[model samples]
Target chain A: MKGLVRTAVLLGVSTLVALDTYSAEPNARDIMEKNFFVSKVKSLKTDSTMVLINDKGQQRERKNTTLLKLQANGIDSKLLVKFSTPADIKGTGFLQVEHSDGEDDLWIYLPALKKSRRLVANNKKDSFVGTDFSYGDISLPKVDQYQHKRQRNEQIDGQDCYVIESIPINETVKTNSGYSKKITWARTDNFLETKVEYYDVSGRLLKTQRITQHRQVEPQPARWVALHREMTNHQTGHQTVLNFDKIEPGVAAPDEVFTTRYVERE
Target chain B: MRLRAAISFAALMGVSGAGQADDSRVPESPAFEGVQAFLQTRRVSGALRADYFHAAKRPDQGSDLLGVTAQIKTLPELGERIDGKLEARITNPALNRDGASQSRLLEGFVTLHLAQADLRIGKQIVAWGRADGINPTDNLTPRDYTVLLPFEDDQRFGTTAIKLDTYLSPQHTLTVFISPFFKPAMISLPTAGRTLRETTPARTLANSELGLKLDKIGEGLDGSISYFHGFSLLPDLRLLGSNPVEPILESHYDRINVLGADFARNFGRFAVRGEAAYVDTRDTAGDDPGIKNPYLFWIIGIDRTFFEEMNVNVQFFQRRVRRYHAPEGIADLQARAVALLNALIDGQRDRISNGISFRVSNKWFNNTLEAEVFAVLNLTRRDRFIRPLLTYAFTDHWKGTVGAEVYGGAADTQFGSLKPRRGVFAELRYGF
Candidate 1:
C-alpha cells in the first residue's frame, strides 16, 4: 500500500510539471510572427528626430519625415524618407521597396547632385546616414532568415517579457547582417519587442537597442507604435536616439509617393 | 582676334555659370517656432564657399575663387498649386577679371501641379540617363569643360525650357520638353595661335530643341525610351583656310537626331544597367572630314556592395561607327590633326573603340569621412583618367573636400591631351 501511494504521488507530480512546462514555453516562430505583425499597419506617416551622441557628449541632430504603405498581398511594404533639417543634407531622400521573394530595391536622391541613384541593398550592416542604427536595424528581416529559440521569462520595468535567441541560418544572412546572434526581449501580452542585443561575428556584444513609449495607434485590429527608441554601440561608445514627433497610423497615401520621381521632388 | 574674344566670353559666361543645383533649407530648432513659421512661406538659404586648385605640370594654370550662393524656394501657401525657385551666386576674382565681382543666375523656375501632369517653365536642368560618370544620351544640357570643379556634373548649367510630365499610369510616365534657344557646350582646346570663331544657330522655330521620353518605373525593372531632335550641343570645326601655322577655323552646330533606350534591373544584391543610343548626324556619307559620322554608343554596367559600406561599380562601353573612314589619309597635316582630334574626342577614332570604367567608394567613422576613386581606360588608344576624392563632414553645416585628377597616355589621345590640366583641388563650404 505504501509503495503504491509513493508511485502515484511521483506520477502526479511529473505529469503536473510537464504540463506546466508545455504551457509556459511558446513556439519561437509563433512569437516572431506576432511581433512582425504588431507594427504592420495599412499605411503610416511620421515625423521624427534622430540624435547622434558620441562618447565625448557631443550631439548632432537630424529631422526627417517618413511615409510607408503596405503593398499588394499585404505582406511587403514600400517606404519613403525625406530629410527636413541639417542644412547640408536637406532635401535628400531615400526610397525602398520590399520584395517577398528576392532582394529589395533602394534608391537615394541627393539634392546637390540633382539626380537619383539606385543602390544595392546588401549593405545591411552599414550605418544609416551616420546614425548608430545600422541599415539592418532599420529594416525588418524575414522571420525565416534566422533560427530562433526561447530563452526565459522575466519582468522588465514591471512588464512581463519573454527572451528569445536568434541565430542566422546561413552564411549569407550572417554576412549580410554582420551579426552572429541577436537576443530579443518582447512583451508577453502584446508581442511588442521592448529591447534587443546584437552580437558581432566574434560573439562580442556590439549594440543594444531599447524601445519605449508604446502607444496603440489602431483600435479595431490592435496596432501599437513605439514613440521613442535608443540604440547604443558598446564598442564605439556612440548612441542614436529616435523620437517620433508625430505618428499617424493607418493613413491613406497615394502610390505615387513611393516613386523615385516623387521622392526627388523639392 | 575673334578667337581671343570668344575665349573671354566663354570663360566669363560658361565657367561662371557652373555649380550645384539645390534648394537648401534653414536648419530648424524646435524651440524657435517663430523663425520656423516665417521660413515656411519663403525658404531662403545660402552657402559660403572657397575653392583653390594647383596644377602639378603648370603652377600658373589653376584657379582660386571665393563665392557666396543664395537660393530661394517658395512653398505653397493657402492651398496654392504653384511654386517658384530661384538661385544666384556671386564670385570674386571672376574667371574673366574684367569685373572685380561677378554674379550669375543658376536656376529660376516655376512649377504648376495639375491633376495628372506637372508643368515646369523657366531655366532648369534636365539630366537624363542611368549611367554613372559618363552618359551618352545626356545631350540636352550643355556643360562647361573648362570649369575647375572636382565633380564633372558641377560643370552643368541650366537652360530655358518648358517641360511637362504626364502620368500615364502609376508605373508609367511620359515627359515632353521644348526649348526655344540653343546652348552649346564650352570646350577648351589647345588653341595657341589659331583664330577660331563660333556661330550659334539662329533662334528660329526650326532650330528649336525638342525631346520626348516614356519612362516605366517600379516592379522588377525600370526602363525608358527617349528621342531628341535638336542642334547638336557639340560643335563641328570648319576650316576656312588650312594654314599650318595659323589656321582660321569656324565652329558651327549641326542638326542631329538621337534615339536612346536604357534599362536597370536588380538581381539579388547586384544591379545591372544598360544604355544605348544611335546618333544620326548630317554627315551620313561619312565623307566630310570636318563633320562627324553617324555612330552608336552603348554602356553596360554592374554594381554591387561588399563587406558593408564599400561599393564597386564597373562598366564597359563601346562606340561603333556605321560608315568608317580613317583621317590618316588626309594630305595636309594640320587638317588631319583637326580631323583626328575630332575623332578622338568623339571616341570614333576607329570602327569600334572599347573602354572600361571603374569606381569604388567607401565610408567610415559613421559616414563622417568618405573616399572614392574613379578611373576610365580606353582599350583601343590606351588612354586613361583617374580621379580620387576624399570628403569630411566637420559639422551638419560645414564640409571639406580634397581630390586629385590625373590623366595618362600619349598626347594625341583624348584624356592624354588634357594632361596639362591635371591638378589637385580643395574646397571648403558652409551651408545654411
Candidate 2:
C-alpha cells in the first residue's frame, strides 16, 4: 500500500509538468476575434458627424447617420449606412452582408450614378476608396475560410496583445488577390484586433492597418468603446483611416436589405 | 506647337480635377482628417521604361524605317478617395514601307489622362468601324505594318480628340466625345489622304480636309456599342501625278464624307460579337479601284473549366473582305478569303491547308501552369499554309511566346509573292 501511494504521487506530478503553459500576452489574433464577437451593441439612428483629411492635411467634414443592425448566424452582417453629416452625403446608404462561403457583398447607392452597384466577390486587396484599409480588412469572412495559427504575443499601437495568423484555402483566383496571408494582433483583455499585416499574392507585405484609439463602455465586460483603424499600402503610396464614433449596437435589421435587388436599384 | 500642348495640358488638368470630385464622399467626422494626411505621405511609387526601334524594308521603300514612339504611365496609389494616373505616348511609324507613296503608322501625337477623359493632339492613331478592312479600323494588325488601308494597318493620321465617360446608373454607363484634326496628303490614294475635291465627280480629282468627328457610346448587358460620323478634307489626284512637282501641277481638293458604327458583346463562357460597316468612297471615273468596299468580321467562342485546375477557351474568328467596282478603268483587284487563309497556312506545324484553328492549354503539369497551343489548317485547293502558336505566362508578371507562320501557292496563284513561307518568333516580358 505504501509503495502504490508513492507511485501515484510521482505520476500526478509528471502529468502536471507535461502540460504546456500559455502566458497572457495579447496578440493580433486575439484582437481580431474580440472585435468580431460583440455580445452587445447600440445604434444611433440619428444624424452622425464625420471628418476626412487628405494626406496634404486638407480637411472635409460630413454629417451622416445610418440605420444599423447586427446578426450572427449562418451569415453575419451590418445594415444601413446613411450619410447625414456632409450636405452632399446626406442620403448615401449601403448594406454589408458577409457570408460563410467566403464572400462579402456591398450595396451602395450614389445619387449621381442614379442607382447602386452591387460589389460581389469583391477583391480583398483593393483599397477601400484608395485608403490604406482594403475592403477585405473591414469585412469578416465565414469562420472556416482561414486556417488559424497562433503566434507569440505582440504590441499593437502600444497595446499588449495576442498574435495570430490566417491563410486562405481557395486557389482558382489568379489575379487581384487581396492577401496571401494575414497577421492579426488582438487586445489581451477583450481579444479585439489592434493591428494586422496584409501580404500580396507574392507573399510580400503589401499593407498594414493599425488600431490606435480605444474607448471603454461602462457596462460591457472586457468590451471596448471605440476602435480607430489606420491602413498603409506599400506598393501604392496610399493610406486610409476609419474613425467609428460612439458605436452603440442594438437594432433589428431586415434580411431583404441584403439582396442583390436592393443593392442594384437602391 | 505651343497652342497644341497648352490645349492638351488644359484638358489633362480638367480630367485630373474630375478625379478629385467624390460625387458624394463626405468625411466620416470632423477629426477624421488623419486619413488623408496618412495617404499624402506616400510619394509616386512606380517605375517607367520607354524604347524606340526602326526596321528598313527595301531600297525603293523610301526610308522604310520612318518613325518613333514613346510612352510613360504612373502606378496605382493606395488610400486616396480617388487614385489618379497619368500617361503620355508619342509615335511616328508611317514610313511608306510598301514602297508606295503613302507609308502610314503612328503619324505621332501626344496624349495625357488624369484618370478621366483622354485628351490627345497632333498626329495619332484613330480607329473607326469594326470590320477588318471593308470598314475603317485600327489596332488589330500586328506591329508588322501592312497595307490594311481604311483600316490603317499601323497607319496614323494627325488629329485631336477628347473622350468623356460618366456612370449614369449602376447598371448603365454613358460616354460622349467630339474631335477635330488635320488631314494627310492627296497624292496618297484612298489611304494616301485624298482632298475633298479629289473625291468629287465633277473635277478630274477632288480632295477634302478640315475634318470633324462625334460619337456616343453606351454599356449594355454583356458589352457596349458606339456610333460615329466624320467629315474631312481630301485631295484629288485623278490626273495621277508622277515624281515630285513642288511648285506646279494640277490638283483638286474637296470635302469627303465618312460614317460608321461598331458593336461588341461578351457573356460568360460563350461569346458572339462582330462588326459591319460601309464606306461610300469616291474615286476617279476611270479608276477601277473597289469603291464601296465592305469589311465584315465576327468571332464565336466557348470557354469552360474542364476540371478544378484546368481552364479552356476555344474560339473561331471569320473575316471577309468584299470589294465593289464601278466597271470603268478595267482593273481587277482580286482577293478571296480562302486565298488569304491559304497564304496564312503555307508551311507550318499542326495542319497543311484550312481556315479552322484549334487551341488548347494544359494537358500536362495538372494546370498549375498554362500553355495555349493553336493550329490553323487550310482546306482550300488553290493555295495552302499552316500556322501554330504557343504562349504561356510563367508567373504573375512574366510571360513568353513562340509562333510560326507559313504559306504556299502556285506561281500564278494569288499568294505568289509570299515565298519565304514561315516566320518564327520568341519573346519575353515582365511587368512592374
Candidate 3:
C-alpha cells in the first residue's frame, strides 16, 4: 500500500510540472486566437487616409470613414466604409457582414450609378478599391481556416514577439487566397501584431506589412490599437500606407448603418 | 428669372463666407479673399468638356463641340426640410446645324422633406431602372437622340414634374410622380426632300401623366414594380399633305399605359437582373393603321467579374407586339414607302423582335485607364452596333476619352438605319 501511494504521488507531481511548462509556451493557434480577441472591440469608428506610393515614389491619397460593429451574438461583425475624396469616387460606400460559419456578404454603392450592388464575397483575393491590399487583407481572418505553428521567439524593433507561421488547411482556401503562407510577429505582452510577411504559392516572398504607432485606449483592459500600417509589395515595388486619423472605440452603431439601404442613401 | 438668380447667388455667397470664416487665421487680402471665395463654395460645381467626332465615310465629316455644365445646390444645414438644386448646360458646336450654340437647364428642382416622405417639384430627371445600359421600365424620362456625346448618360433630358417618395421601411419604398407637362423624344431623321413637324400634347391637367412605383431594396434581393399612365415619348407619324416629290409628315404623341417590374439578385460569383414591361397603346382594337398596338418588352442579364478586375455583362432583350399586322390601304408608292418606314420605326410591323447585348470593361494603372467594349446584336433583324472606348485620367480633375460607334446590316434595320451616323469621337473634360 505504501509503494502504491508513493507512485500515485509521483505521477501527480510529474503531470503538474509538465502542465506548467506547457502553459508557459502556448501553441501558435492559442496565441493567434488571443491576438484576434485582444484586437477586437465592441464597436469602432475611424477616419482614415490611404497613401499609395509607386516605384517612382509618387504618391496618391484617398480619404474615407469606416464604421464597425460586433454583432450581439459575437460571432459576426458588420463594417461600413465611405469614401469622400478624389472627387470622381466621392460618395462611394461599401458594406460588409462577416460571419464565422458561412460566407460573408458585401455590397457596394456608387453615387454615379445611384444604386447598390451585391458583390461575391468569396473572391477575397481581389484588390480593394485599386489599393495594394486585398479584400482578405482588410478583413479579419478566420482562425480555423489555417493551420498555425510556432516558429520562434524574436525581438523586432526592440519589442519581444512570438513569430507564428500559418498555412492554409484546405485546398479551397489555398486557391482562394493570394498567399500560401503568412508569418506574423505578435507582441508577447499585448498580443498586438507588429509585422507580417506573406509568401506566394511558389514559396517566394510577396509582401510585408508593418504596424506602428500603438495607442492605448482602455487602461483597465490594456487595449492597444495600431494607428498606422504600411504594406509593401516586394515584386511590384509598390507600397500602401494606412493612417488612422481619428478612432472612436466602443461606439454605438445600429445594424441599420450596415445595411445596403444606408449605403445607397446619399 | 432675376429673382431665382439673386437667390442662387446669395446662397453661394453665404456658403463661401461661412467657409472663409472657418479659416480666419489666414491673413486677409483682396486677392486672397477672391481666390478663397471661389474655392470655398460648396453650392457650385462645374465641368468643362470638349469633344471631336469624325465619320469613316467622309474625312471632313467631323464636328468639334465644347460644353460646360454647372450644378448648384443649397446648403444642407440651412435646408433641413427644404432643398434645391439647379443644373445648367451650355454647348457650342463648330459644324453642327442642329444647334450652333445652345443653353439649357438640365435640372431644377426644390424638395420638401417630411418625417416619412419627401416631395420634389419642378424639372428633374427621375431614373428608374436596375439593368445596365438598357432599362425597359424607365419610361418617365426623355432622351435626346441628337446629342453629340459619347456616353449614354449624357443623352438624358429632364422633364417638369412633381415626385413624392415615401419610405415605408429600410427595405421598402413607395414613389408617385405627376407630370403636368409633356416632352416628346427628339430624333433627327434625314428629310430627303420631305417636310417634318412634331406636335406635342397640350399642357393641361387633363393631359397630365401619373406614375407609381413600389420598391423593395436589400433583404438579399432587390426589386420594384411600377405603373405609368401618360403619353408615349415616341411619336406617331401622320401624313398631312403629300405630293410626288415633296411630302409633309406630322409626328404626334399618343396616350399609353405601362406596367413594369424589375429584379436583381446575386449568386456566388454571378449577378442576375430581370426587367419586364407591358405597354398598352391607344389602339385597343389593333385595327387602326395609324396607331400602335399593345406590346410586351423584357430583359434578362447576368454580370460577373473575372481576372481580379475585368467585368463582363451580357443581356438578352425581347419585344413582342400584340395583334400585329402589316400596314395596308396605301395607294401611292411614296405613301407605301412612308408607311413602311413609319411601321418599322414605330414598332408596328414586327410581331416579335429580340436582341442581345454585352459589355466588357477593364481598368489598369490603378484605375487611371479604362478600356471597354459594348455591343448589341439584333437577332431578328441581323443588325448590330459596336462601341469600343478607352478613357484615361490625366489628373484627378482631368480626363480624356476616345471611342468609336460602328454599325452594320441592312439600312432598314434599327442599327443599320444609323449607318451614315457611324463615327469616332474623342473627348477631354475637366471637372471642378
Model 1 stretches with alpha carbons more than 4 Å out: A1-25, B1-41, B56-79, B93-100, B242-245
Model 3 clashing residue pairs (backbone): none
Model 3 lDDT tens row, B313-403:
9999998988776555566666665666666666454679999999999987666689999999989878899999998766555667789
Candidate 1 residue-wise lDDT, A1-266, digit = tens: 99999999999999999999888767887888777778777789999999887786656778999998988876788899998776667788989888878778788898767777777676688778889887788877888999999898778778888888999999888888999999988898888889999999889999999999988887766777889999999999988999999998877988877987678776
Candidate No. with top TM-score = 1
Best by lDDT: 1
Positional deviation of residue A257's Cα in model 1 after best superposition, in angstroms: 1.6
What does candidate 2's lDDT look like per residue over B1-432, in tens digits? 334433443453344343244222423344534543332233211111111112122222222132223333332342332233333334333322322332233333344433323343434334443221222322211123232211112233334444343443433334444444334332222223222133322311121122233332212222334444433222222323334422112233323233334443334322232343232333324122212222233434444434222334444444443342322223322222222222222121111222444455443221113455544333343444444445443322233444554556664332333434334433232222
TM-score of chain A of each: 0.92, 0.70, 0.90
- Runs of candidate 2 with Cα error greater than 4 angstroms are A1-144, A147-157, A167-181, A187-266, B1-54, B57-167, B170-222, B231-289, B299-316, B321-432
> Per-residue lDDT for A17-83 in model 3, tens only?
9999878887899888877766666788999998877676656667888998877776577889988
What is candidate 2's CA lDDT for residue B325? 32
How many pairs collide in each candidate, listed in order? 0, 105, 0
Chain A TM-score of candidate 3 vs. true chain A: 0.90
Better-scoring candidate (lDDT), 1 or 2: 1
Clashing pairs in 1: none
lDDT of 1 at B40: 40
lDDT of 2 by residue, A1-266 (tens): 99999999988887766542333333334444555664224332334443334444433444444554445552355555655333223235665655544444455555323334333333444443323544555555543456567787777667777777877756523233456787777676666667778787679987777776665543544335345666666665445556666455444444443432233221
Better of 1 and 3 by TM-score: 1
